[model samples]
Target: MGLLDSLEGMAASAMTNSGSDQAKVAGGLMQALQEHPEGVQAILNGFQNNGMAGHVEQWASGALQTATPEQVQTGLGGTGLIEATAEKAGVSPQMAQTILATVMPMVISHFAPNGQAPEQSQFSGLAGQLLQKFL
Candidate 1:
């Protein structure tokens, strides 16, 4: 399995052993990250590698809090992804956020139920497609 799928599998196991709200959120967040291949790949070997579960256990499971809505928006707003999208599509930041907001839910759902992660091929296609949508 790919890093993405492996992360989701770990998250699925984490969910079964969830001990707190934070743990659940972390588990879900991990799944979501895995499902979003681009995001996961960005940090695949960065920090959330073979030790992701430990990071979650040490931080997210307790001290690691999930990001707020503002944080999520700000993160997307600050990323090169937004500018690239806007430039390609010739749309404003506001429009970009609107599109991202709509797509965010789908990304979440992609990791739903069993916390299944998406395929890298799918993610590659999606990442390019999402960027293209703005273009």
Candidate 2:
């Protein structure tokens, strides 16, 4: 199946299984990021400012460190961000937080396979591809 189909399956499975929120968060986060012109930088800055730079390095190195929902919430700057994701994902903010805790690391690792964050322009293109998959 195509990546979009795969992601749709994943989302459906999440909703079906009734615990994993990965797909919901992935879609919401991607949509939220796509809505921002400076999204890549803003996210990177959030990681940096929230002292999750080392975790970002883990994502860059493909180690995939687990970030807590609280951590994701803090990294992204709390309720406003969570609410935005919830609105996009059609889930609660708490669910958005849970989903982001999983999805964010995967996304960072996918975009930074070489252990360095991509440039904003490169990330934008890649992020668009990711967003498309979930849509």
Candidate 3:
């Protein structure tokens, strides 16, 4: 299998194992990217450089905690992120619960150097930008 293919299988397992909608999470990630495209890009780059599933899990859990069921379904469900998630290592929706089952303590401990949520926004401006750029 090629890279995307490998990513697809991993996403299948990750989503099945994760028990949540990949669309929602991916959408949320997009939203986050929209809000702070540069910051989100930087974070993704950091994750890539670190190549650590644990770190991805921590960040994903934090991002998903207060997320609603609608957010879960629309963002993660059937968005092909099931395959993409393996690339990130964090699970979605219910899988997030599974992935974080024993990781609560660790998630609480991580702090941004600036001590703030970088992608924090009520709306995803970067997502719009992405759509505009792609469309």
Candidate 4:
């Protein structure tokens, strides 16, 4: 199956297993990130360019600093990721921001372990692992 199809399946499975809004939003954000042309790099770059490189670095280094919703909105403001995630999760953009505040750090840490971003080829495997964790 295509990556999109796989992501849909994973998100559906997550919803089935947990039935939690957070899980659904996490899955949606994962889908959005995967579907982005730059994938997770765009997210990293967004934070980096928005003067939130410290936050991204902390997350990459396995620190557990939680992003505030406003921080999430600022870091991800123009990426269109938030809107995509909101649509996929069937949530309002504001709600997506709130959920993303909690989830984005984990996503970054998983995909960019030890302060390094994974190769694009590694994304599929890592995404599955991440989805499992969220579920």
RMSD values for the candidates in order, in angstroms, are 13.7, 5.7, 14.2, 1.4
lDDT of 2 by residue, 9-35 (tens): 444444454433555666666556645
TM-score of each: 0.35, 0.69, 0.24, 0.92
Per-residue lDDT of model 1, residues 1-135, tens digit only: 665555555545544554443333344444444443365433322223433433223332234344333433554543345444444334454554455444443333342212333455565334333222222
State the displacement of the C-alpha of residue 36, model 1, in Å, after optimal TM-score superposition: 12
lDDT of 2 at 58: 82
Rank list by TM-score: 4, 2, 1, 3
- Count: clashes, candidate 2: 0
Over the stretch 34-72, how does candidate 4's per-residue lDDT look in tens digits? 788877888888898999999998998888778999999
How far residue 88's Cα lies from its native spot in candidate 1, in Å, is 2.4
- Quality of model 3 by C-alpha lDDT: 0.35
In model 2, residue pairs whose N, Cα or C atoms come closer than 3 Å (at least 3 residues apart or on different chains), thus clashing, are: none
Where is model 1 more than 4 Å wrong at Cα? 1-72, 111-119, 124-135
Query: Given candidate 4, what's the lDDT at residue 21?
Result: 80
Pick by lDDT: which candidate is best?
Answer: 4
**Which residue runs of candidate 4 sit more than 4 Å off their true CA positions?**
none
RMSD (CA, Å), candidate 2 to true, equals 5.7
